[model samples]
Target chain A: MSSDVAVQIDRVGKRYGRHWALRDCTLSLPAGRIIALVGANGAGKTTLLHLAIGLMPPTEGSVSLLGTPLKPGRPQTLSQVGFVAQDHPLYRGFTVAEMLRYCRKTNTRFDQAGAEGRLRDLGIPLNRRTGRLSGGQQAQVALTLALAKQPRLLVLDEPVASLDPLARREFMKTLIAAVAETDVTVLLSSHVVTELERICDHMVLLRGGRVRLAGDIDDLLAGHRVLTGPRVDDAALDGLVTATHGERNSHLLVRQPATAPTHPRWEAHPVNLEELVLAYLEGQD
Target chain B: MLWVTWRQHRAALLTGLFLLAAVTVPTLVSGFAMHEEYRAAGIAACLTDPEARAGCAQLLDQFTAHYGQWGNRMIWVTFLPALIGAFVGAPLLAREFENGTWRFAFTQGVSRTRWLLTQLTVVGAAAAVLALACSVLFTWWRGPLDAMSSPMRTAAFTVSPGLVALTLFALALGLFAGVLLRRTVIAMGLTLAVYLTVRITLEETLRPHYLSPLVRTDAQKAADALPPTAWVVDEGLITTAGNRLSDGDERKILQQVYDGDTVREGGAALERYLAEHGLRHYTEYHPADRYPIMLIIEIGLYLGLAFALFAAAAYLVRRRTS
Candidate 1:
């Protein structure tokens, strides 16, 4: 595995009882960039994140983080990674100060004042009970805890799924600010690709427990073209990802070296990130 | 890890300390008064001096009638250990799982084994200390009453230092239930129920078998007074032929010998009838001096169970998927 890769999964599979949550999955997340993980519900997005963090071990294959093998609950691995689970779970009864102290004592690399300062900037009181905070404030505190660890790879599983539009914007603002201040590789999963189109530089699209598409976002868009032409057989297209055809006409989303098609009869249009993701997602059906 | 554990459980720990103070204050106050009353009644002198005991019986009876009921009421202290388990131990893990906070806790730099062991050690040690404090307080409070009867009795036995082991057992049982059940209320309820069952079963059926009861019989001195604090497990009338007589059969024989007359009405005739029958009283009892040895045995037994339970909880945590 490349030392520059933040997370590397090799033929990893996770099974819950008789059902496979993730199977035959392999990906290398590049360092120091925001990567978006997209999939439908139960499509194994959470399972992949959990495996990457060493929260749960893979039944079949191996996963490594930051060039070292992933071992769940290991001090070294956990110190290098920060994870924000789906609900952003915190101790409801504890005051914000107590929670900060808890993180400080439990983690050797914790930045206590930095976390408190983030909360302070957000106007979140240190003595306030965690349960009393709004959902947005709670999400910020959870993020603060993760950021305070000074992790190399930060894994967030649907951090903004439950937030309002304003909260989502604020969360993204804080995340972007944190990214700008530090060279942290972020991998976040979300259902809406449009929201991530501008923020994420890379993408991993999953469907039915498998990686359907994964690459640099700009590269993926630049390599694919939407060609409108007369009906043609599968042999006519160089790399067909998805196709929509009528009796007399056809529209094909195909991956190639450039944005143009070689055939004179075809008209090529550059695909956007949303269209590219949608094509692969629809192709799964 | 220590700060985190304390921070997480400070509220419960403080509340426990407050409760200890609450119980200890009253015991201290009432204990002093009861001791003063015992001294005024001269029960200790009466107990130690055989000649004075006969003269002080009426006075001792009055002291017991006034204060013995309080000793009976102290059985409630036996349940405090279980209560401590429910409040402090059950919530140790169950609350995290119930509120989905285990994801945050276990994902930290600390391993699950360290997390669990630290919590159990800190909380279990605190519980043992609290139980020890309560035991010392209640045992001191029961000193006069214990002198009146015996520490071997349930009312006094359950509050002795031996009960610290039972408290630790309760705490471990609560932790195991919390991990197994994963619901705070249900785990607390089950811990209490299970702790009570174990206590009752041990006291009633198991404790007596810890050692065999000693038997003593007298033929000429059939009516001699036994030690006042010996726990008499069994007593019977034996004939010269080595055949034991049931109480009912002995009563029947006395009735036939007296020709339906009451023993008080024909005391000399009753004595002559008993002599002619060659009968003597045989009593099997656990000596009161064995109290410390029994306490040590029970403490060892319950502490063994507590440590085993703690180890089981740690194992479950290490292997748990959630």
Candidate 2:
């Protein structure tokens, strides 16, 4: 409900028949910030994105964008929010330029010049049809279309999975630059946490249709550590928050400050987003 | 906005041209040349102009009777458009959704509803144009045949541009199939089934009743045109101006045509046709105005189906994830 809140998810859940796809999951995405959703396969990442974009109604809860509930075909809500699902659905016969032209014609907030300029910078041929492109190129065109919508909240299911490492890096670089320059709030779901580490300040980790951890990236990583010892017991490290435990010299993750006595026994190091996500997922198990 | 729909269906347009050629060539070859003949009285004979020895054959006359043969002409008219539609409509939006281009359209500023409706508009318009072209061509081409093949109504609306409703009907079916199956091959098959099912049902059983009492008759004028006076008295019917042929009377009309007489359908419908056209006691009669009635019903059914299927497809595409 905050004025800066671009996405507000209130206890949303999605189920296909009795099978739970997402459950009791909630997160409020703030404006002008990048939030990354990282999860393994079947972790409910795509479900959360679909719900946020109002493509499907949640079975139990609500998802809203820009202070209004997201409704399919509601002009105002869609005007401020854009979504890109996996596989980059596009009209095959239309060239990249033609697709951009259609968006410009259809959307009130579409930025024709901006989209064209972005595609130009990315070395994507404006006249080439997306169907003829490689998997990576098609993904770029899809991203370019979504970005050009000039939305307040951009929810992408998996924006760069098809890209080669180089194309992926370039896409991320371009996206980060855009996010840095604009007040757009982005929520991108991916399994590759490393690609998001540099730009994302907020993170949400989903597992088994539930949120295992969600908060500011800096704060979550700061208190967490990969504890190592000659023979440290998991029960011995119960007092501190153990994000995950390994078999040998368990990599204990803690959110609490260590006492002077326990300081020498634990090795406190800054956990990167990838390690932090793995730690939390392991801990949940 | 509707023009946007046209840009999307350029492929359908190209495919329609091929269909037009396929339909037109046969009609031209049969109509412009070739005399229809049969063995009769130990010699060759023509169905219509048996007495004529040469110049134009009976086949050419029947072909020349383009306007005269209402049902047969209609068959020709609707077939080409249907063929065109079968080729293009199955792929119009099915290819897009099957290949997953809907993702681009849905995720961008355009709502799924807008994008889908626009596509429908384009395809529907193309159907309308194709139907109109066939109707106009067939109607114009059949000037000579009207007297013998169709005499009750001045107009015979079998498959006109309105029949393009059939194509729109097919397009809607294909699009819905695309959403359900998510593959062009399966979608095309679904569309074919729907087109055949609806078209067959409409054209066959249900359609005869919409306007009530579909009538067809041979173009013959003579004392022989009258069935036995005893047969009429037996059916509790009086002799009107024209001979009536019912949907159940295909064989009767063929017999009456061989006897060189006019055939109508159902005593009541023929009486009405005779009264409406003021063609009392005519040997050959086919009224033309009844054609519009058929076209109207066809158009209504097709549009209704297309809109409904399109709505369903939009719902599926907007909600389902890959």
Candidate 3:
């Protein structure tokens, strides 16, 4: 509805034949913030990212990027959003220099010099064929190309999913450096959450084609806490997300403000990002 | 987009050029020699001068014997369109889907339709140019032989300007299959199969019937009843009762008439017997003057098919998600 909202998806649904990949999905990703989209495999993460970037039309409802309605072949909408698909596909036969030139030709606003400078700094040779590059270098090149477009919203689907730990770290370093240099809103999806906790300010967790939780990282962490007390019925706790019990004690992950009054016999501890994500993922029956 | 298409497909385009050159160089060398021999033998003058008919027959026969097989071998050239469809057109989009480069290419600032249309134009234009060059070269090479036989026949027809449209049809079919099938080898296989089926059907079952054949029936078989360059659909004897004899019946009667007799005496006796029986000779043929109309019809057919295939491919590309 507003320019400050980089991507707005309203009750969007996608169906492949008889199966629904995503349903009733609604989100307003704010501009100029790094938002991490976390979901397990087949959790509709890729489907949602594709809809936001206009890779395909949603079967029902609408998606808008930068206040413009998303359409698959509209150049105006396409120009404002950059996407790096899973595996960072590139023309295997093209030299890195040719790949850069190709990107420059296709985009109206391309930072050719900036991209070359980035590649040079990273020690990626201009004349080397992309197919010959290491997986890490290819990812960097893909990122550089997307950044060169100077898009308002950048959507990445599983950017580092296939990389080794060292390559993953290097790829993230480039991504973080670029984010620091630009005002672009990023919505990157990953099945793994540990690496994203430090860089992402906002988070959206998806489960079974639905959004399980979405909020600012700090508020989400602060709003949910784990409580341990003597064994009690599930109904005894308020705002319970998930509960596990032993004969002598019980632990409950609950959603409430940090300053909420607690029972005298129970102990409250802060939940880490991984624990919070897993609890929600596992809690979904 | 133009640069992108060119850079991506330069390997295939260059390979097409190299193959064209490989075929053209040999055809050109032999074509020049054949034309020289045609001139030196005076076959062109023989074709027109009725007074020289007697000597011309021997000369034409000698010239045909020298180069006739070479012209027939040119039938293989018709396979060029099939190869183009399979190798160039099939891989055009199938490679994108197979390699997952469509994700990268489609998400660029240019719209997907613009990207697809631009690539099609570039590659389609290249195929057209190649087809045109092949047409011009082969048409020139086949000129001496066309003066002997009819250009309406398969050997010459396959290499005419109609080939340009046929090549485009093959290419469009390949592109459509590439998008529909999404696997390079499978699309190629389908393109080749469909192209051959269409071509063979058109040539065998449909071409001769493009227009009705002219039939001539007479009491005696006249020397000029049919032109030398006419495409003879059928020829046989018509019985006194007005029933046309099948080729098999004619062959059996001729064999019975010639049994155990001298060739010269047998011919005279056969004519007398045919007269006594009141059987007439009939010849069905399409005249050489119909060459242009036949070519136009064939070209129109292929061009119309090409247009339909292209439209289908465009629709599929537009509707495709992911």
Best by DockQ: 3
| Tens-digit lDDT string for candidate 1 (B73-113) | 88988887888789877878788888878878887888998
- Using lDDT, rank the candidates from best to worst: 3, 1, 2
List-wise, what DockQ does each model earn? 0.64, 0.38, 0.74
lDDT per residue as tens, model 2, A247-285:
566566666543323557667665566767776665645
Clashing pairs for predicted structure model 3, backbone only: none
True interface contacts reproduced by each model, as a fraction? 0.81, 0.46, 0.75
- Judging by DockQ, tell me the better candidate of 1 and 2: 1
For residues A1-285, write the lDDT of model 3, one tens digit per residue: 224888888999999999899999889888899999998899999999888988889999999888778876688777787889999999999999999999899989999999999999999999999999999999999999999999988989899999999999988888999888678999999976888897898999888898889988999999999998898875456778888888989888999888999988889999889889988888755
Rank by DockQ, descending? 3, 1, 2
Interface RMSD of candidate 2, in Å, is 2.7
Residue A176 lDDT in model 1?
A: 88
TM-score of chain A of 3: 0.96
DockQ, candidate 3, comes to 0.74
- Cα lDDT tens digits, model 2, B1-322, are 3545666767668777676777677666554432221122211323244345344344445444543343354565545444544555556556666675655555555666767667766666776677667666665444344433432231344534555566666666766777777777776676667677777777655554555442333332233343211111111111355444344554443454445444545344544544454444322221244445656776787789778887787777666665
lDDT of residue A92 for candidate 2: 71
- Residue-level lDDT of model 1, residues A98-186, one tens digit each, is 88887888888999878888888889999999999999999999999999999998999999999999998899888988888677899
